[model samples]
Target chain A: MSGSLQTLSDFLQCLIVGLRLGSVYALVALGYTMVYGIIRLINFAHGDFIMVGGYTLFFTIPAMLAVNDKLPIWLAVIVAIAVCALVGVTVELVAYRPVRKKGTNMTALITAIAMSLFLENLAQAIPAIGPNYKIMRRMFSNKAVLNFLNISLDWTTLLTILIGASVMIGLQLFVKKTKLGRAMRAVSEDKQASVLVGINVNRTIIITFAIGSGLAAVAALMYFAQYSTIMTTSGTMLGLKAFVAAVLGGIGIIPGAMLGGLVIGLVESFTTGYISSSLADAFVFLILIIVLIIKPAGILGKNVGEKV
Target chain B: MMNKNTKLKGYLVNTVALAVLLMAFLILNANFKTPFYSVVFIPSLWQISYLIILAASLNLVLGFLGQLSLGHCGFMAIGAYTAALLSLYFERAGIFTDKKAPVFIVSILVSLLAGGLLAAIVGIIVGIPALRLKGDYLAIITLGFGMIICNVINNLPFAGMEGLSKGSAAASLYKTGLGFGNTLKTKYAWVAIVITILCLAAMFMFIRSRFGRAIESIRDDEIAASASGINVSLYKVGTFVYSAFFAGIAGGLFACCNSSLSTASFAFTNGSILNSTFIVVMVVVGGMGSLTGSMLSAVLMFLLNYVIKNVIKASGMPLFVQNLFKYPMLVYAIVLIIVIMFKPKGILGTREFSLVNTIEYIKGKLGKKAVKEGGSK
Candidate 1:
């Protein structure tokens, strides 16, 4: 009985970690799915926005913490989100807008890839941000608030889940009740029709990018807090995983992204615990391939047959 | 009969142009023992050939079939490892021991074929399910496949091993013994050049055949092509397999010439020859569906990379300037964006350059000048 209980506790512990990781993936995946919904193009650089946000915090948090040891998490979160949104909007306007106007889908796709490469290489080349890891300062103590039957719940884990749930609920309400959210939905459904009906399609798209990027910023903070390190290329793998999560949940669906993120996180955690940690990535990709093959529309995505 | 005659003439012109170019290089390599030729030009020649093969193969899928696959490097890595393992096995079996030159040539041939075949098999397996999807989904799936391949290779115990030890920890197990250290001390420039030309000819012929027309029709309109009874799925899978085959052969050549084989070499990161972005950039800049354009851009990009690296090394520039020059990918990204924005169709834009076209262009220019003079008179 004791052995079984211990095993149960271990499993539950893994679940808690999975949930924490899933929330971060959910936040980033929301950005990917939203941008993809609004524009048919996959914003390849969306992943890089997380990296940008990470670097923003990497630069800001240490200096602020040095000046005042009691810096609020909210202040850091707001500043990072603002900077990330600014960068996201700038990228959409400067790099993506012109290409979107005068090119095919292939061209736009290539441009997005180019933008990804440009951002990554530029970060590496900059003297201040050379290819090195920056250790992120801790914002809160990871002290256990609850312990029951050999299972402990930490403060950081609680905060991650609470923030994630609140943001998700808030987003759900915004999309359902707000005028801007309605405009976004209308534009995604039919851009021409939405424009005809007096929705600012471009503005809606920009706001979508802002919201997505801001969420990515939050994800970046949580990720850094957990990992305690930030690198120029850290976002690549995380972004890819979140993308898989989004696709697994049925892309362009909000709740689906959340569910998918959690599922992927659980799968990864279980694989790492049971199987070889190194092969965990391979398994994740294999799952992605299988999911794509079996249900290309994803779990919650509607299958729209091609019109002849 | 006239068409046949023109075709024959076209072949003759192309052969002569190729011969002249090869002869120039051979003469320079034979006589000019300068550091410039040996250190830079020769290596750059082989690298250019590799890139051309990669770009042309990817063009068949991306440009001709209208499918985006971002995992060409995965196939290349497959080929590289296959070739490396085969050569090592042959060396262990003691087949090519006495006569070094013949053995080297035979091993290279075998590795290329074996590597290409294996890669094609993997390609077909990946393509069957992946091809059912469209656009960005296909791209992501393919990217996932590439990463899977990289991780698998990194984790696999090298050459002779008992069991799969964890991830990249197994990298320490294998020894890459194929290239410069063991082989005959001769430049591989000529071999790469010949192989590149043959691959180009094969791709060109395939593109102009009836099957090529079907592929192009599918690209133009999938529904129309399907209506015309074209087996869309078969053609898509076939194109992908063919592309992977060539990519594998290129990988074999790269493994043989460069001699260093690491999983990182095949990753989708900056500065790796096996990177998908670099290959896509080559095809895009060269003009999609134009073999000549891909070839031209491949050579041009190689030269640009070489120049940037060398110039940075030679110049006494500021630290910041030198730092910028250290990453050629930054320049490549800028160029890619500019190309996509301004000339989305690329430098050639589905147009091929030929000796006949060049002659006709010159004659047309002369005729126009003559007409202008007559009008003036």
Candidate 2:
């Protein structure tokens, strides 16, 4: 009986870890969903945009550390967030706007991919910013500890989940209450109609990208906070997984993104720990396939009849 | 007045072009003693050829069939790994055996078969879902499938190493059959290159055929193509399988040339593999729906990569930037963006060179000249 109970405990413990991890996926998924909701285009580079955010923090955190080793964590986090938002806005203006103006969705897809690829390579090519940024080695090696319900957890894990959840709630409030949020919803429903009502469609698109990318930056910071390693290619798989979460939750729906992410996280954690780590990705993909088949639109997605 | 002469000249031009290409290949192989020629130039040519095959095949599906796929490298990796395993197995069994026929040819044929069949199966599975979804949804699902395949291969317990060991597996797999270090046998690289080139040529011929026209029509407008009695699903699956088959062959050739395999080579996180997508960019930049354009872009991309790497190595760039230069995907991304902005339709833009277009152009030029002479008169 004791052995069985111990096994159950371990399983539950793994489940909690998965939820924490899922929160991060959920946060990133929100970005994918929001942009996808309005545009019906998957921003292929959104994950890389998140990487830009992470890289921003990667550079800024070190500079802060150099100035004063004891600089407050909140200040460092704020700098990272602000820098990521700037990058998000720039990516929207430079890469997305031109294609959007031309009314070519395919061109936009290709452009976003090019933009993402450009940033990744640019990061790899820049002398000061490339691989020797030893800051990851210094900051990520240390772990903070926390205990709950007879289970011990790392402080970074707890902090990442907290930050991720708070941002989601914050986004929820922004979308539900603010005028900009209402404008964004209108634009998503019908771009021409929204424009006719005096809404700045381009500005709203820009704001949506900024907010989405800002959330991605938060995810990036939390990601680094948990495990401090960052590489040029780090965002590729992470971004893909987050997009999966967005799709799983009913892409373009807010709450659905959160639910989908949490499910993915738990599934990943349990599979990796209990089953073989090799099967982790395969399992997630299988789940995605199944979900898409059952609900082509997603759990929270509205299944609009094909107009044909 | 010059029409007949220009026609003769065009024929002469084509013949001379062929001769020059043959001469260049012979000189490089037989006369050139430069290490640069062997290590970089030859490989770059081979790489471009491989990219041309992949991009052209992909265009049949994406450009013509209007299906998006992020799983192209998976097919290439499958082909490569299968070929590598076959080649190593035959070399170990000995070229001349008292029992059964020589396995070398058989092994390569089997590898191609395996690559084609395996890719077909996967393509069929992908097509089922793809048939339902349009646009970005299809792209996302396909991307997901690609990641899954890459991760699975990386994690496979081959070569006795853990956590996606590619190099070690190829070594062990090779050693198990060939008595070890046989991959270092030099003749195989030449053989692999020959086979790869031949396969690419065959693929190019197919793309120029009438069937290729049917495929292109599907891409231009699937609904119209279907109304014309074309089986949309069949063509989609056919193109997907065909593309994957070549990608697999490329993968097998990669394994043979490199003498090893690793998940590192197959996954997108690795920049080299990401550059695999450059073939698509090349196709677009050279000209969508033009096979020659695909060929041109492949060669151009390969040359750009070669120049960037060589320039960085020689220029004494700082270590970080130098390391960055080693990854060509960045250059691909930048080139793609610039090309799309200035020339969105690509260089060829669905146009092709032929006797008819060439004659019409000449006739137009002469007509203008005659008008000038008449005015002067």
Estimate TM-scores for all models.
0.94, 0.85
lDDT of the candidates, in the order given: 0.82, 0.69
RMSD (CA, angstroms), candidate 2: 5.1
lDDT tens digits by residue: candidate 1, B281-377? 7898888989889999888888777767778868898887886778877887787788788898888999988888798789999999999999999
Off by over 4 Å in 1: A147-152, B98-100, B159-176, B181-186, B271-273, B316-326, B366-377
Give me the displacement of residue A199 in model 2, in angstroms: 0.8
DockQ of all models, two decimals each: 0.74, 0.49
- The 10 consecutive residues of candidate 1 chain B with the worst lDDT sum are B159-168
Residues B38-142 of candidate 2: C-alpha lDDT, one tens digit per residue: 665555555665676677766666666666666677677666555555555555567524212345546655655666567667766766765566565666676
Q: Which candidate has the highest lDDT of all?
A: 1
lDDT of 2 at B278: 49
> lDDT tens string, model 2, A1-308?
47777787788789878978898899889888888888776776877866777777767776887899887554565776677677878877886776676735656667777887888888877776675433452333245475544566776677777877888889899999999999998989898999999999888988898788878888887776766777776777788888889888888889999998998998899999899887898888778877887888777888897432
User: Compared with the true structure, what per-residue lDDT tens digits does model 1 show for residues A103-143?
Assistant: 87778878988888888889988778888887877766789
